[model samples]
Target: MDMSIVLQAGVATGTALLFATLGELLAERSGIMNLGVEGMMLLGAMAAYWVSAHYGVPWMGVIIGMLAAGLISQIHAFITINLRADQVVSGLSLNFLAAGVSVVLGEGLNSIKGVAILPSFTIPLLSQIPWIGKIFFTNQGILVYIGYLVFPLVWYFINRTRQGLHLRAVGEFPAAADSLGINVYRMRYLYVFIGGLFAGLAGAAISLSISPGWFSEKTTSGEGWIAVGLVIFAQWNPIRAAFGAYIFGALRRLVLDIQGPMMILGLANPFYYNPYFGFFLQMLPYAFTIIVLVLGSREAIKKRIGTPAALGIPYIRGERGM
Candidate 1:
């Protein structure tokens, strides 16, 4: 019942959503909404798990996973960006495609041949501190370190760089950006592909770090979709996404951590002790996602902003729709 353990696990669990939210934010920034995040994540998990089990190189799994997700994203890029298809439909299609393919590919691998987790590291002097070090630094994997490094760099690139401005401009007003000589299609493709890369890493975090092994079942659960919801609550900012992801992560772990107590309390109260109580608690994370989506949309409406202007809208060259 130690608080630190729960907090630590929550933060570690949140790392997957953190990478996912970051990637989605980047893609949305360029006005391309790649909803295939869940599918891409699944493929990445499968790829990483395969490498970890067979190649015996955990870090290599990260690299291969990213590449695999990146490649899968290109399909969406081609359909939506090149073929000018509906982004939502195209992205959703990839979800089914990814789910089926991952299972088929892993059919022969024995579940007993479990994968290994990435090695963990701690800061030299800082890790010796009291509660602070234990909560923030100790007993974390390399991906956590890499994830921490991503926030600042992403913040800088999106807010400070000239290219970042162009990307934003393309998302907000692709027509105007096109008039100003920016290739809207090119920017969209680039950002969407980059988003896939992050999604891939997110998947790797699950198999190679979070769960530390592979099972036959779908690994990500609904985490990818939850990450999609997190973007709105975060108002499309990487820093805010990190905070929201952590909050959601905490909720995810809290259900398990408190299950025994909740179940114990149920012993006295028929409602609390009912077998279905656990299911309700388990649903809390996804339920919160729906709340965020609803409330977040209203808040965005009040502020006159929530998403990129052209988000989920396919860009047809030289055509003005609005």
Candidate 2:
């Protein structure tokens, strides 16, 4: 298998993961831990596919998908922010709710065919470069290029800007921020909504660009969970998150590709000969995700580093309980 093809596909796949991970990172930075990413993603995918199939407009699908996911995300925000419910429980419940809704609503979508899909194009001068061009610029989805710009912009926003500082301050010291006139509840709600928007966009990327159809819950196939794990792996840094997303994407593609081809290092490909072996190969990505999650969990607990201090804690005005 050509490694360039693997990487190019990885970049496209990774763009979806990048959006989801960035969304989660932003919410967590504001002291809101949302575990409903999976549900939001599934709903986004279903909504995007449904609109595209019906309207024959991919962009319209993208918009509706995002708005639908963003709207649903408010449920979690209200529960955690207003009712002071457990973030983990609220997120998990939201996940199940969104998944069931998508499956029910997306019932007949699988039979739909020839729906317009998001376009893919190659860059002019940049596509002529050597290895980098092949992996990033040539014949890639427009969203992939957008991913390139978004990571740096997000990094700057989080680390260098005043608003970014306020976000971090709210996460680290909500009471302090409240004393300084920053509306703690407002900021939390806003970022949680933004996170939902990003998650919705991630779902759109998959249905409209990467995979190009709705497969119900299988449309996301647990990529939302993987994105959550990636937040910990990225250490709450956008640049690191982008890198990890692409690497995981590449690994996922590689696992599938390795199952094909006639030879591996001049030897017969066992996976090709025994197709059932592909199941084990397919499991590699999720297995790696689990390993990364475990390692990241240890690091966060051992050092208490990079984790927002007030995360998963509700902030009541005029109190320092969190």
Q: What TM-score, computed on C-alpha atoms, does each candidate reach?
A: 0.92, 0.97
Candidate 1: where is the Cα deviation over 4 Å? Answer: 110-114, 128-130, 260-276
lDDT of 2 by residue, 183-273 (tens): 9999999899989989999999999999888888788999999999999898898998999999999988898888879898999999989
Candidate 2 backbone collisions, by pair: none
- TM value for model 1: 0.92
lDDT of 2 at 276: 95
Taking the tens digit of each residue's C-alpha lDDT, what string does model 1 give over 30-136?
A: 88888889888888888888888888888898999998998889889999988978988998998788767877886765464655669887777777888767766
lDDT of each model, Cα atoms only? 0.83, 0.92
On TM-score, the leading prediction is: 2
Which predicted model would earn the best lDDT? 2
